[model samples]
Target chain A: MAKQFGLLARFKDTPDLFHAAEKVRDAGYRKWDTFAPLPIHGLPAAQGLGRSRVPVFTLIGGFCGFWIGLLMVWYMNLYDYPLLVGGMPFFSPIFPFPIAYELTILLAAFGTLIGMFVMNTLPQHYHPLFNSEQFLATSSDQFMIAIESSDPQFNTEATRLFLEEIGGTDIQVIEE
Target chain B: MATTTSNLPTCPAQAELLDQIRPAEHKETPLVGNKRDFPWVTEKICTIVESRVPTWWWVAFAMALFTASFTGVGLVWLVSTGVGVWGLANPVNWGWAIVNFVFWIGIGHAGTLISAILCLLKQGWRTSINRAAEAMTIFAVVCAGIFPLFHVGRVWFAWWLFPIPNSNAIWPQFRSPLEWDVFAVSTYGTVSALFWYMGMIPDLGTLRDRATLVLRRGMDETLTPLQRKVQTAIWTLRKYGYGIFAMGWRNAGNHWRNYEMAYLLLAGLSTPLVLSVHTIVSFDFAVSIIPGWHTTIFPPYFVAGAIFSGFGMVLTLMLPLRALYGFHDLITQRHIDNMCKICLGTGCIVGYAYIMEFFIAWYGANPFEEFAFINRAFGQYAWAYWIMFSCNVFVPQLFWFKAVRRNAAMVWIMSILINVGMWFERFVITVTSLANDFLPTSWGYYSPTIVDIFTFFGTFGLFSVLFLLFLKVLPIMPMGEVKFVMPQADPHGHGFGDTAQGANSEMKGGAH
Candidate 1:
């Protein structure tokens, strides 16, 4: 049997898309998403999506990098070889600040990148969303809402009518 | 009220009727063109990458390649012969190589200033120029990294600079600025490469999609086996390559939210790095005991000069290309004017630093420092010093005139002069301080050998080659970011409905 993908609706503009998102959220559809060419302000709130947790990952990465820098410098400079030059002391907090600061930033940047990918579940080369011919316009100048067929309340005919009522145009069923 | 009405030239009802007929016009200048719409932007920018390479691009590429090969030749000769092939002797051991290193590193600063700093400040003009500038930064650093790596003389043993466990268990000196430089430049290069690649991801998706369209159209009436195979290969490569990089960016609200957050944080992280990287580079000289090199003001002075030189190089590259590519709409007169203003401001700061160095040398009453300043202006290397002053200080002052800044030819000429002046500035700092050190007997006049000259020229070739190649491969402008600044980008804006209707029609027409 051919798998049922979802119902995809194209909106003419963002206001229409926002209103559609409100209706869909009110309809309590869990497995759905909105797409646009650029990030629309307040769209996430309109759909009632939860906040992302990438910042927490960044914080942890920063602290770990800070300690790694401090310890690496200490072990190498003081504990391991301890060659005294310019009559300066073996170990000091002041000397390692530059390396520590650099590491903190480097690790935090990596964390942000990794956390974003992890949270989004990206590098998804193939998705049912890509199966639609018109769906490519979502990355360009179009706004779209896709409610997966896997949603608990999804009905083939009823969902199409509901999308039309909410001002979605050119509604189509996506198949996998 | 009756008297006011009687004094009016026309009746109030008549005036009200006229006002209703003609609405007030708000004549604000757009950042780009008035006719620039979403499809126009996507088509225009992508076409640059999709089209065949132009004749001028080939000519430039050939020149860049010819010059860049000198680096290989020079390096091979340097490795076969010892460090003695070039000029490095008694007191003036730190010579042209160090000067070039500092010079190239300084040239890399403007990219970060445009991409990261201006981004934080919400400067929309940076969108058109940042991609190219960032590429330049990465390439310039590659050129800069070469000098220091070879300067250690035994290129094979350069790994000792890092803290890897060894049989001898000897560690690199942590307190030294040189060690800090090793970390700073490497970290800078890594972060810059990551940032550049991250920004290129969305544009890569556009290219991929465009390739798919072309492939699909070609597949409809394909003829030969060879053409079929080539088309399939090209399509597959673009699809997989873009797929991996773009990471499924659908411009979903949640994806953008996280992406924007990450981008902003990275910008914040890189801001301090801009100040820190050059400051540490400055410390290489300031921490020294040499009279002219050692100073409290070196950090800010070096930072200002770096920005000055960086902007100079940016203008030198951007002006000609902008004219040739007809990017005037995207990179407007205002953008050029703003960059010129920054160059002028930083140049003045550099000029002030020159004056203050002299003042401090006299005011502090340090004989070595006093002689160092006097010797720079009227000593054996006085010609170089005066050239630096004239180019760095005098040339930029031309920009104070509106006519000069607006004139592309004049700006280009001044930009080249500023770049030359900055190189000479580094040369004067490095050679002068070491040549006229405290001991008269140890002091010697330093001059570059043919090898030194070739090596330095080779680095420029290397930088140009990388940048030119980059221009061909990537979308030199950020199409996604540019869209954000467009008037029609806002969904709820007036006339958005009309714009959408036009876009829909255009999409439908293009689909067929």
Candidate 2:
């Protein structure tokens, strides 16, 4: 961690982040990030963060929810004291479907929310990213780009030359 | 350098000019770390839009109050005297009460339909109209609910509708269609209310951000303190809301997939419920061996009619109200066009149902059914039949043209006429069939008495009063959602082109 050199490139705004990122990537920097006061339109593509794995969790959640709903209805209607009227069949799926579908959705939704919170490492106590005072402006107005020095191709002189050539402003080294 | 930057003027003369013409300022509560000196809202704008309620709004509200009181008075007389006073005789047992109930409930379908359905379609137009429509849905459902509760003369025994069996040792006969109705209507009420409130939470937070101190205080009292603790309450809500209301909206990239899936599920669920509800209502007639009521097509036919009439009611309320409230930009010509298209489609479905019913009566070679259909067209209730025909079929035909569809006044008038036509259609269906069923000896003409008339009118009064109150208190539109829908919010275009200024700049090669 101490020996590795990271690339640092800052964008004055979100668009600058996008264009600068494309240039940096073309120049062969593998790992990087763009940050602004809010989510930027093209930053994710610039970071090369591929499609997320959130849906796999959601599907599993949905399946579990379906079975749980079925069991709840079964216990209440068939297991408990059964009362039948008008000769309608007991434990009819048509009648129970609304409640079942609602519960299935309820559980699945809960699972997805929890999964996202876990994956994002939310409620962080501390972050090395916060150590830079200039970075504090990212929460207010300025937009920034940080390319970790740890990438295989990262060389202090080469990366600094590359970032400056591509119109990056306020380049700096961020420590771990 | 830092001191110089701090000394820079907050707004130049040009920026102040821009602010004068187009108001822009953050009006949210001061957070612990806010660096800005003064908040955005000017004293004048706050005084006009957010000050004490104006007199005219109050006057209109009072009139609605008077109408509701009259309805209450009518109900008191109805309970004390009996069902006998208001035209529920032998052949015509169902009258104005059931008619209004079905009308109001049917009216509610449009709101949920617009919010849930269009959101799935990824239509940007929904942002403006969806907020008010959802509010209208809740109020209309409330209005519709009153009729069924009051229709049962023994109003005290309404609790019997629930599954709970008391000392009587009698379980509510699960086979009865009305019992299904109790579950369906109540469940619909619960889900719709939850969905509406969930949708409103973000908008309420937006209002919290934009509101004056007085308005903020009012909102604070309404929302739990815990709900207000976060600055990005609206953002957090959407993050979770898209999960809960949208049924686990993970895989942010596959937005279309999740949105489409959730929509299809809800649509599938609701379509059947829509069919089942009216079908059960029709079963009240169909299960009985009465000649006019024994048709199998009653379920789908009735459901189509319900959707038709419901859309009509929505257009009637939405068209004029949007104009009155200065929401024309949000509820645009395009929305009106889409609604008109649906109205025409459903209107045709209803027209087809009318024809099919007559054809079935002929095909079955049943004398009783034949006579019932013939009488509905040519007998004592012929006026209602023609009124239904003209409004449901003829008036809506104008929607086939783009010009008529886009014309606000024409569409508004047509929508009202369609509602009138729908009421007559229900009245015609319930009354004309029941009266003169098989035996001429029991045949009778049904007419609504003063109580029946007032009770139905009272429902309108109740619906208007609730809706007006909603406008005054809540953000009439979902502000946070509109902001999120802005091009600035979406990080990826995915497929569709972006719509906000931030996105526009990318197109023109400018600011991010």
Candidate 3:
């Protein structure tokens, strides 16, 4: 809590926070974010954020899992040590489909969890925002906007005025 | 109507809020009763975890712990003596162990159905109950895994089910249905846990915040005892403990964007995952060419029965907890009604599956199949068959009446009966089929030994203990998701919501 990290502003409610988000996006501030207790529908678009890249990871994991499951069956049964049982073909995909399918789901879930962590860069352990006691309420019953001082358009006085003009209350400079 | 319209405020936002609030032709029951607000939802759910344990909680926990100890001692004795202590004979090599396995795993389906399937369907009511239900799913799976692992007779060597390539260099039969079960149950356990924990993160943060707010004094000044000083130490642990597991969740919009995406994807993956688990489990019997088990309909039937039994278990757990905790607002009557309807619906499917099995046996004209069906209904195990039929089939039919469905006491009884019926259903399916097969000389009746009975009985204890711990430690309901379903959670709406706030305000003073 030494250097000014950003300008923090609290909004009255969701609609107010949502509108403020639109203004902040229009203001073209890149190093900024909005916080809410729960996911607000259409907030991402209002905040000028695109869809998440998590699905790509899930698909990649599923593809790898399916092939891995299938090949493992083949390797174990036919390549490594072939054994004859019930006069069935040694490496038939039909017999081993359940194993592969289960793996596909297993790995796909792994991918989704891993991908989400990667996308969010989570387990951050620390952030400048945590220093602001008022900001902690964002996890429960409050909505807030934080525009980082590192933004290219960082003017301390102007940014403070801009936030005040947008119906923000309890405006504070979060120190990092 | 004109006066009502004109009395509405001149503000357009206020007007739109009224229309949305009005009861239209498609009137639906209130999802959350008593009009609970966001903060109220968080406080109500979190305080249960934060406050001093109630006296009844201790009583219930002690009983569950006592019951679970039977399983612990039974398993130790089982491993020591060998699998022979159970009622294994010439025909019934597979006994109560397999029956309990299927029963426990089948009960887990409802949780997945509520959390994953209902989430996919956009069923908003699921928000209030999904967290507990998902926890039930994970715990039920743990109980289910024990029987199969130990029934292998060499519990220590259970790791051999997986293809880790030990010194033997030999591989498991990749084509075996039992092998498929190893993957399905393990994967189901892992993914269900992952889903349950992921959903809990935000709710955990809610708990963490409240716990962190006042570490010197416990959450409730009035409720804190002399032991509250001790609770402060626990609070310090909670702040960092829930903090670390909360994964630094600040409820930032960017994090939620990715989090929601992952949630939807997991739900998508879990749908097929849940369906496949029981399907593969059914294959363990169906592919084996056993007379009763060799049907094409086993997968769908098993899945339906699983859902039916799962919902029954949900009602069994939630109804008592709801009444004890005074969660009428959060877990409204509509929630109970809806679960009754699901139980009724799936119970019908199970009944139909039962009839269809018999129909196919007669229709197919195979002597073994015909004998299996007749013997199932009228054989030495006729008593079990009647129990499964009456409870699984006949008892649920009572839910067709609105009176029965709405009656909490009656529904609770039905839920218990439904569980009993389902357990017997599995017992009948596993034992009857194996007991009196093709050979008359080899056929013999299976009776569970003391160890077998105690082992199966112990699972209920194990399930209750885990659930009781969950009730005490975690936010039993998903507060964030429940808040998500409230009208005020809508982004475009004026904040106080139109529901009761606008209407009540306007009603108090017309022409505002």
Candidate that scores best on TM-score: 3
Model 3: colliding residue pairs = none
Tens digit of lDDT per residue, candidate 3, span A99-175? 99999999999999999889988888788888777887777778899999999997889998999998888999999
Candidate 3 yields a Cα-based lDDT of 0.88
- Ranked by DockQ, the better of candidates 1 and 2 is 1
DockQ of 2: 0.09
Taking the candidates one at a time, how many backbone clashes does each contain?
Answer: 0, 3, 0
Ten-residue region with minimum lDDT total, candidate 2 chain B? B32-41
Model 2 lDDT per residue over B386-426, tens place: 99999998888999999999888898899889889888887
Candidate 3 residue-wise lDDT at B312: 99
Error of 2 at B139 (Å): 1.5
Model 2 segments more than 4 A misplaced: A1-176, B1-55, B211-272, B484-512
Model 3: per-residue Cα lDDT over B1-512, one tens digit each? 00112474789998888778844432566577765566777778888987888999999999999999889888988999999998887799988888899999999999999989999999999999899899999999999999999999999888899999888888999889999999999999999999998888887777777666766334557655766667677899888888889887778888889989999999999999999999999998999888898988999999999999999999999999999999999898889989999999999999999999999999999999999989999999999999999999999999999999889999999999999999999989998999989888888989989999888888889999999999998889887788777766666553333453333433111112
Instruction: Report lDDT (Cα) of residue B197, candidate 3.
Output: 87
* Candidate that would win on lDDT: 3
Model 2: per-residue Cα lDDT over A66-85, one tens digit each: 67656655554556546664
| Ranking 1 against 2 by lDDT, winner | 1
Q: Point out the worst 10-residue segment of candidate 3 chain A by lDDT.
A: A131-140
What TM-score does the A-chain of candidate 2 achieve?
0.80
Return the number of clashes found in candidate 1.
0
lDDT of 1 at B172: 83
